[model samples]
Each structure stands twice: as C-alpha cells, then as structure tokens.
Target: MFPTLHIAEKTTGSRGSLALLRWALVVIFLWFGCMKFTSYEAMGIAPLMQNSPIMSWIPAVFGVQGASYFIGTAELVTAAALIIGTFNKMASAFGATMSCLVYAVTLTFFLSTPGVAEPTAGGFPAISAGTGQFLLKDLVLLAASACLLLASIRPADA
Candidate 1:
C-alpha cells in the first residue's frame, strides 16, 4: 500500500517525474539509434531482418543501412518531439505505431527461424530464449506504447 499524501494539484513533483520519463525515453531512443548505425556488422541482425518475409520490402529500398537510418530517424524524431513537449500526443501516437510495427516484424522472424537460440556469453547461457522471447518482450513494450498513446488522447471530461 502507498502512503497517502494530500498534496496540491500544482505540485512540481508529478510534473518533474513526467519530465524525467520523457527525457529517459529520448535517451533510450538515441542510444538504440546510435547502436543501429555504429554496430551494424557485429549485430548480425540485418541478415535476419532482410530475410524476414515481413521485411522483404525493406531491403529493396534502403537495404540494411537505409532501414537502419529510417528506424533511427523515427526514434530520433519521436524522442525530440516528446522531450520538447510541443507535440507529445502526436509523438506518442507515432511511437506506438512504430512499436507495433517492430513487434510484428520480430514476431514474424521468430516464427520463421527454427532452432534460433540466443547466443551465450562466456559460460553463461543466454537470457533470451530466441526471437520468440524477443517478440514476447516487444509485444509488452508495444502495449505500453499503446497505453501511452491512449492516455495522451483521452478526454479530460471522461
């Protein structure tokens, strides 16, 4: 149970937390985007992505680099919009759509790949069970994004 605090509606704490979350999301997006650009070769995900039937159209246009750039730009723009707080609703909506797309692509890849196990580090077994696990996690993230988008659009009167 949480402690009850009869605080004023105008308290800075709630607003500050919201700001923190916004910035945190921005940092996460920037980090992932940078990773996609910088570590393309080592990641080995590009081939899987290219082979994915769901992403077949992606390789035709930008190839791996172009796809990476496009995804990176989306993340960067979403982060910027959220941080600026000028277009929070639109940004969140876009982010939710992006998350859903990612989830779908990853899920399709997992389903197509057989015996695709996560790589082990040192002597320890990998944490993820493979693409299926990745899909499951991404789905949860998609749900979270959807919730954020919904909350952004919710009517105050309701």
Candidate 2:
C-alpha cells in the first residue's frame, strides 16, 4: 500500500479526472461533429456507413451531404447539452444518454463494415491494425460516456 495516498485525496483526484474526462468528451463531440459537415469527412465515413445495416438507409433518406449535416447537428446539440450540464444536471444526463447511443452504433461498425481487419496478415477476424485500432479506441470513449451517464442519473450519489 502507498502511505502517501489518502481516501479524501484519492476522491478529489477521481473527481478531477472525471471533470476532465467530461470536458474532453464535450470537445471531441463538438470537433468531430463539425468535421462531419465537410465533404472530406463525409466521404471518409461514407463507405463504412454504407456497409452498415443500421446506417445504410441514411444515405437513401438524407443523401450523403444531408446525412453528414444531420450528424453534425446532432453532435452540436449533444455538445450544447453537455455544456449546459455544467449548471443543469438534467441536461448533462440527457447529453450522456445521447452519447451512449451514438457510441453504441459506432461500436457496431466492427461487425457491419468490411476491410476493418488485415487480410494479408491473418485475414477476417484478425482485423487490420489501423482500422482495428481506430475502432478499439471507441471503448475508452464509451466507458467515459457511460460514466457520465451514471453520474447524470445518480447526480448526488455519483
């Protein structure tokens, strides 16, 4: 055991970490959401979205440009709600819920999209190092979003 660590001190540190995590999430959502509005970003994700059963129809209904704008709007709104959470826990809780739902869909891309794994190295389940890595990073964001969800729901308890 570390003699230097104390319960109160640890709690303070944990709280600080959570605050930073929440703020980081807010920034990422806003930034990425803004990127979705650009043609480069839209096209970059189009292939993955097209292959996804859960997302394929998006293009049909909204078209690529429209879909990208919609995604950007959603992200902007989510970020706004999270910002509001700084004062209103209810708003933050709603934002966290939205974030959880979005992250869940992105996680599903591992199964829905092709070329996500390395074919030459091991093929199929092996997963391409780059794509696999990109998808893998979502787990941390998912966890952070979930933590925010719990915090929003429990408020005082969290």
Q: Which candidate achieves the best lDDT against the true structure?
A: 2
Please list the C-alpha lDDT of all candidates, in the order they appear: 0.58, 0.82
lDDT of 2: 0.82
- Model 2 residue runs over 4 Å out of place are 1-13, 155-158
* Reference-based TM-score of each model: 0.63, 0.87
Q: lDDT tens string, model 1, 66-113?
A: 777766676666666555542556665566456456555666775555
- Superposed by TM-score, candidate 1 places the C-alpha of residue 40 at a distance from the truth, in angstroms, of 3.1
Task: List the pairs of residues colliding in candidate 1.
Answer: none
Supply candidate 1's per-residue lDDT for 116. 47
With candidate 2 superimposed using the best TM-score fit, by how many Å does residue 81's alpha carbon deviate from the native?
A: 1.1
TM-score of model number 2: 0.87
Candidate 2 C-alpha lDDT tens digits along 1-158: 86785566333236567678789989999999999999998898888789889988887899998888888899889888888977788998898888887888888988877878888977777777776668768888888888887777774753
